[model samples]
Target: MSGEMIYPRGSGAYFEQLRALLPRGAAWICEAGTTLGKLLSGLAVELARIDARGIDLIEEADPRTAYELLPDWERVAGLPDTCTGAPETARERQAALHQKLTSTGGQTIAYFIDLAAKAGFLIEIDEHRPAVVGMACDAELYGEAWAFAWTVRVLPFNGTQQGELPVAVAEAGDPVGIPLRGWGALDLECLIGRARPAHTTVLFAYEVEPEPALWFDFTR
Candidate 1:
């Protein structure tokens, strides 16, 4: 509301304070319009400028308002890792930084899902279990390997066309056994892969809907 600065005093304020400290007889050296007075005024201006910039630097130290120090924050977070690529925009980078700072490592399905959500994705986790006699008759039979395997089903991005999702899904669908994948899959695999149980395996799946067919206008 008020167009005023409170912390760093202005150049005129600094000049007055500097003049006040001069000794009684020596005060003439800093009298208005004198050479010494002009020099002192200039020095005060520089000091005031530095003081104002110091407050800005303090603000930059905050992660939420950080711009110049964003790289330092990313380094501390160990970001731009194997999965999440370097953020392409300021907002994107800020979001990634927030995720990195707030996240505590976890192994639960909900944990992984929340991790994906932070990266702007919605996902489902399916834990596989070996077929048992009491299981439903129609349940697909899975072997012991399935016991250690889990699938991360990434739902298509909301409001996106059906065609775009498959490409992202395909890029992200690699099994955890292979080298890590990037992009698509929202860098999710890498985020969770690090926190997943060492004994278990991770897999990715994409859920896409079929596009509607074009109708012919021959009847017209």
Candidate 2:
């Protein structure tokens, strides 16, 4: 006989196991069409249903497979508290939840840049300094408050540079090989704002892609 049984957990398997447990003389009472056999078959169905439900619970515990249980995961992660405009799509939501749970929290510029990159954005941080007597001639004179102000320069979304998702993020449901092609920078802004130091002010500067240089082919 083959080692693999196609209906390993089906009603027939359960019925045979159950019938084997009964007293030897009870065979007549447990015949296929008998009422006792019917009862055993029904019991087997409930057992199979219970086994399936247990498997589903295991799957729901993982963020990658927790479709219906995502809301619960979000609540546990304290989502939408400061991260406004909760993501509507399942992929985005899962990514958000994964990001929240995995973030270790940092205040460094590199930390912020890495955060944005993982979310599919390329950015540069510019720290502002007050104009001093020794400053260069081209420097702008500003108050001391500028010392605590910084700007995050967001480059135009170039799929070649920023479309690559981190391993963990890709595993969270974002499709690989496809670039994030859109103007949804709000999420990146919110993320930076939330993580910035309490006493410091952060500004965002979005750089639009410059028009491509056009050359006349008059020589043709």
* TM-score of each predicted structure versus truth: 0.71, 0.66
Q: Give the TM-score of candidate 1.
A: 0.71
- The ten-residue window of minimal lDDT in model 2 covers 163-172
lDDT of 1 by residue, 26-112 (tens): 546775567877787888889899988898899678777788898888899887788888879877888888877876778887888
List, residue by residue over 1-220, the lDDT tens digit for candidate 2: 5332233365566767876777777454765556876777777777777878888999789876677899999889897565456788988888877877887999898999998887678899999899889999888898999999999998775646745323222234667774344345767888889889999999887666733569677887
Residue 180 C-alpha lDDT in model 1 = 49
- Which candidate number has the best TM-score? 1
lDDT of each: 0.76, 0.75
lDDT of 1: 0.76
What are the clash counts of all predictions, listed in order?
A: 0, 0
Model 1 poorest 10 in a row by lDDT: 161-170
Instruction: Show the colliding residue pairs in model 1.
Output: none
Superposed by TM-score, candidate 2 places the C-alpha of residue 200 at a distance from the truth, in angstroms, of: 1.4
